[model samples]
Target: MHGPSPRRPPMRAGSLRDGMTSRRDRMNHVVLTGDRPTGPLHLGHYFGSLANRVRLQDTYEMYVLIADYQVITDRDLPGSIQRNITELLLDYLAVGIDPAKVIVFQHSAIPELNQLLLPFLSLVSVAELSRNPTVKDEIAHSSQQAVSGLMYTYPVHQAADILFCKGTLVPVGRDQLPHVEVTRLVARRFNERYGEVFPLPEAMMGEQPLLKGLDGGKMSKSRGNAIALSATEDETAALIRKARTDSERLITFDETNRPEVANLLTLAGLCLGRAPRDIADEIGYGGAAALKRLVTEAVNEFLRPIRKRRAEHTEGDVRRILAEGNERARERAVITLGEVRDAMGF
Candidate 1:
């Protein structure tokens, strides 16, 4: 049941190794997810996670983070860290994630997340942190001699993100399973080293498969294969035209044989709530050009409402909403910090 599955940790279970039983079943439900605010949310993000966030908002005390601190690990500029906050909010609003029910907050505003980072860093050895491939990959890619301290301890910031809210579930993709494990280890180690102040958050893996970019690679901004939610209809159509489909005159959707066409089909499927194969069948013998046309239409139609809503969210209003949400988040966070200080005689 295991491979290089990244030393995965499940909530309510890690204490088994430490011989400390937890009453996790009796606790109230809290869920957390969001972005680093380095850029806008693309279809990959929307298809992969945003819609489900709307549903989760109803069932959980949802807390969405604009992880500004995490962006410095990869980002080159500091200005985007500040501007992307409003851009991220618009993306969230465009995707139908209701801010009323959810706490839309930023990492910088909640100083408790950074404060929690200190004790958490002490709980785990550097050897344990080095074992995480994410950090290793980051260090390998960095322009610096050694990675920045934030890059090295990104997982701890994430651990702080989840535990500060005492969040029990983090909705994420498969690539992020390791980060969740790091968070779980951090939580368990903190509790073992200190007191049981935070719950170990489980990774509530999303049902949606990873959507591919037009270039037939995993969807990412760095790769230039993503379809940004903020893109115009003409822009999407033009991008689809350049999508790296096979030379097969007739369009077919087999991810193994034709990943480019499959990517387009998958995008259409997510928008229409149909299986990719079904969309593939519908486009049978229609030719790659026709498939591209169909996909462009679907994506443009899907984004119509989103773009409209985004336009309505003026910069000032976006700031006001984030400011209000940040205040609410800080209120909850400061309360948690006060308890931690009291518990530790700080």
Candidate 2:
């Protein structure tokens, strides 16, 4: 004689070595993951990596890096880079990324990562870098324009990021497997040449690692198709209100054919913790309008507390957090660099 269960609320949901501990937990394997601070983090980022980071941080010695250096590879906006760095930090905190649990540090602050980059550069061949699928896809996406040498060699830099922190687990999308492969190659070459200073990093992909963009493309800020995590309720509603859907009056999840509607369904399902097909079935013959409205409401509900928490943090708070992270990152960098220099007889 019980009534139907009420709908549940949406689930609210790094760094690096500046917060390193002197404990003997170094024997425990560590995870290193990060994002380029090119723009605000979006829902795509949430499902793609942020969600996984939140879960993994509790179990692993997590190092979440704000890849400030990597941002300069494609663009030359120094001012935007600085501002995005802070924004990125705020986004991390807003999404329930506990700094105390994960050492969230900036990539550039650790000079050891850069030093490792140089030695790794010698290990990877230009042809090898060119053969990377991500590099080719990115370069092609950048309008086939002339890219900086750094842009071309970024996979090697990524390897430096992983090995510099001795990261063993790198959570990434399936498409990023090549980057992790190169990291493994670089680690093996270095270990074979000098000594086993780094562990071979492996790619960890979640069951659903990617979330499509509003425009039925890859969710990306550069493409202007992403819904940022810090977007206001109104902004989120507007974005979903504008999301593309098929002309079919009936709501259904057919990702291969009805990709756009399916994408919205996926977003709603993720926000509400249900399957996309379940949502599609619930909507039934209500058509795209009803589907959009439900998705908008679910997305806004999810973002409400996150936006509120984000508003509470000021620029000064972000700076203090980064500074502390930088210090901790430097501590580990110093130790790693000294060992590397010794091994290389530098």
Candidate 3:
């Protein structure tokens, strides 16, 4: 016989502060996660995770971060860095991310938040930093002479980002579980060593299967496998046009054998909310050219309204939205920073 269904544990005392809050407190539990914003949101973004962020906004207190400083950890160019912050925000607004629901703020704005970083560094050892899989993977990829201290201790920095907000839940993809684990470790050490000032944020992990790029490899902008969310219809159409496919005239979605075709089918599936195989079968009967054409049309059509919405926006509007987001973020940051100061006996 099946056992009783698992129950959600009671919300912590901090979450109970909602009893004092207005607006039904749908935000009893806060969720925090962000892209490094090294580049714009891309097609793989839509298929895998953007829709979930849109939906989760109503369910959790959300903070969508422009990790402007973190971007410099990997990419050190100044001009590219400044341009990306604006472009990343534009991408966020284009894809129906409401600033009212989800705060869209930059890391640089909350300058005081960096103080948490120093204490966090002391909690984790140099050996622990060297062993972090992400740092190792990044170092492996780059034959650069020296891995910067920021990049090496990036996990602790991530912990600062999460704990600073006292975030209770963080929605992250599975590959990032290790990072979340590191944050939890920091929380445990902090509470044990200092005080229970920050919540051990739980990983509300994203179950969305990792979306691969058109080349069937990891979806990344640098790889040229990306379809940028802000790209024009003509631009998106051209990218899809160049999307690699199999030699055969006939088409069937076999992700293992025909990953390129399957990737396209998956994109179509995400838009129409159907299984990739099902969409593949419906369109495959007309042969490869037809399948390609159908996907191109559907994707462009789907992106059309979003791009228009983006176009209608102005820099002033974006600045205003970010200003609102910044204020909301700063309000929370003030409380947490105050608590941190008290904890450290300042």
Candidate 4:
């Protein structure tokens, strides 16, 4: 069911390449980035996008959305969503995503946001939606025997998520490039047909866009291959111990031939801020056990401060943060919806 990886396209707007002398110059760029509260975030989440968000919050008008409404697209229950949202907030704060600089809100909080979906749904064809590789990949991997209506129109809902807030930049992995493209198309079409209301959002990628799972596949919480940010020190060490590595005694960072080992190396490299190959050379002939030990140490040390900050937060704090962010998001959504309505003569 896995499809060929798509080539990463150049950013259509908000190219960080443009020289901006001051923070004031960067303030005009708006960034929409977030995660589904399906489970707690993992190291892959850290290196892939969360890390970039931490860095981007200072420069851009950042909106970190917890896509709670999208949880129902593939699942039947919403029981754990509340818990997952709390965990996500804790992870965000621990990783230096300042609530003051970034608006972290849930999907269902802003009614006006969802109101944009109806108009956006009209902007794209069913064929275009079906052609989205990210949606197709999700459908192919989903547990549901039949794709739900919500799952089919997931990209359009995402378009609402981005356009409702006038998001000009979206931080995404390569797999998600298509979804951002869908948002761009929706914005372009809405502006062209109606008036210039939405900005064509661009996709921003991190140095490490996709991190492999411990088993050398996609890193996912459901698959039990990811080490959650909430994981205790012992839990992280145990997970790293069980990470799949080849029998070759010499450790090397060859992503093509030795992906499992290379994944572990990548984890360690990301944690220690060093080249994976250099780490490999240092641990040459040490085999998988030594490599795992190094990774375990690096990961635990890196997460020590983050996990400590995470534990210091109470559920009430998370709720309050969400409430404030939801209010902010609603204010923005109301303005955008008014513009859309005026353009459509609604």
Each prediction's TM-score versus the true structure: 0.86, 0.89, 0.84, 0.91
The global Cα lDDT (0 to 1) of model 2 is 0.79
Off by over 4 Å in 4: 1-27
User: How displaced is residue 8 in candidate 2, in Å?
Assistant: 13
Residue ranges of candidate 1 with Cα displaced over 4 Å: 1-27, 136-146
Candidate 3 residue lDDT tens string, 1-346: 1101121111222221122223354357777767776777886665444555665676787888777777756555534766677777777777767787888887888876687788888899888888888777666654346667778878888888888788766655445657777888888898898788877776653334566777667777766788888887788778777777877766788878888888888777665556778877787557667776877787777777678777777777778887888788877888887887888788
* lDDT by residue for model 2 (57-175), tens: 77778888999888877765544878899899898888778778878899888877898788889988899998899988777766325777887799998988887778877877656
Instruction: Please say which candidate is ahead in TM-score: 2 or 4.
Output: 4
RMSD of each: 6.6, 6.2, 7.3, 5.6
Give the whole-model CA lDDT for all candidates, comma-separated.
0.74, 0.79, 0.71, 0.82
RMSD (CA, angstroms), candidate 1: 6.6
TM-score of 3: 0.84
Better of 3 and 4 by TM-score: 4
Candidate 4 structure quality by residue, lDDT tens digits, 15-43: 33342234454468789989899888988
The candidate maximizing lDDT is 4
lDDT of 1 by residue, 1-346 (tens): 1111111122221222333334455246688898877677788776555655665677679999988877777645555566778888888887677778888888888888789888778777778787788777667655555566677688877888888888877777556668888888887776776677777777664466678778887677656788888899888899888887776776666878787788888788767667788887887888788788888988887788778877777788778778888999898888888777776778
- Distance from true position, residue 155, model 3, in Å? 1.9
Over 4 Å off, model 2: 1-27, 143-145
Could you give the candidate ranking by lDDT, starting with the highest?
Answer: 4, 2, 1, 3
